[model samples]
Target: MDDQPSLARRGPRHSTNLVGRSSEWLESCAFNDAPAPLHIWGVQEMNQGLFGMLDQAADLAEAGEAFHAYMMAMFGIDDEQRDVPSAGRQRFRSSFLRLIQGWSFDSNGPAGAVLKGWVESRFGVCPSFHKEIIDAVPGPAWEVYTEEKMSSQFHNNAIWVQLDLLFEFCQWAIRRFAFPGQSHLTLYRGINDVERHLIVERTDRREAVIRLNNLVSFSSDREVADCFGDRILTARVPLCKILFFPGLLPSHLLRGEREYLAVGGEFRVSVDYV
Candidate 1:
């Protein structure tokens, strides 16, 4: 068995029953001493499903039970039927406890260097970032995994999912930040970490409000109308870049009628899609 992380290029090996699960290896890596391993962000569906269980729940504690089923399917955390180590059997317990506790990655410090580099490559921009809130940046890392493993649609809905996740995560974080006004943002799927968001607002056309992005309700409707040629420029996310973040995003893309997650800026605005 490989005891260390491989650095050299290796071809895909045939499946084996004995290969150690990364979850176990990750735990063995001894990073557990850090903050709780955070829950998956951009899981609007999971949150929705959990909400559905609230009424069925016997009490407040049992409300989110159904949500665990998805987690099991996605992460295989509860697959005890396989003949594996006793430590593996205890996997579910540890993972379960970790879930309720909440986790985080130290992005600004040395530990998050890998993640920062990964994000930069994915988005072609170094994030104006902080260490503690790496999870808040929202990437589609397991979107494809979620769909294939669970047969759910998540790709098309990624923009909103990440946006909503970050918006909500920032609520409880109590961190001070300046978003620096971005117009275009690139998204990435984090294979081992949260995907990245490239906020592209500081462009040459910063003054020309040709598009009033729904992502940001920057100006009043009248002002936006006055700036653009068409009175109502519909704003939408950039689509070509969707395929940029590989993995689960492109594999299990979201489908019909469930396009957006409703990011309201409480300002009347227009949009321009590329």
Candidate 2:
């Protein structure tokens, strides 16, 4: 916890870190990724001496910077280290390998990357909807699912983020049609970090993940059902995993949002969603 700038780098056994196989993995799989909020800073810092891209939201070099930053950050590197130049063939390949390894990009990376890729190709924007989401959506209407503010191992002490699938879709629809009305993508709260991540409910095999902070919260199970027309928590088990926590969870948790915050930690009752 004392080390902010310095990060723990695990030189997993050579078998655990397969550079060549990893490259093959990334090369074969479909890539869909967005810049996590923390990654944005990393990319900007790294791309400083590189591209003079002016646009914050649209430029390709900026997008590449953001992507590379995310790749570096996944390797447990500090944000500043994210931009180390990879001009050489070996260095570029190694750096890229680190990302493949972090993603466990064996056959497929995590769902977040796949989904973000979809958002990118379809909407032409990254999913780090920091301001864009709040701007387009009205606060009082629908549900507002905001991320929790957290400092932990997996998430690397970064603030949390959520994706309201339905709301995001609504936002997409509005933008695609150039509709001048508003966004159904409001904010939602409830279910602390653990519960938010406990269920691996699938939208599909490709988009099976729904972020805890990004979904609407009902005071009870009935509420969860009535609001989203689906069940996130059982009516009787209103607070299930949300209230209880663990230390070092399943390896699957190592991927996507679950990995963002180290999964294994003692329980600390959560009171707020950022």
Tell me each candidate's TM-score.
0.21, 0.18
lDDT of 1 at 274: 18
Q: Which candidate's TM-score is highest?
A: 1
Model 1 scores a C-alpha lDDT of 0.24
Candidate 1 per-residue lDDT over residues 1-274, each given as its tens digit:
0001111121112132111222222211122112122223444455665345433545322322333354445444444412222353242322321211111212122222323232222222222233222222333432321222222121222322332333332221211121223222222111111012221232232111121111111111333233323222233222211111111111111211112211111111133321
Model 2 lDDT, residue 272, Cα: 26
How does each model score on lDDT? 0.24, 0.24
What's the lDDT for residue 70 in model 1? 43
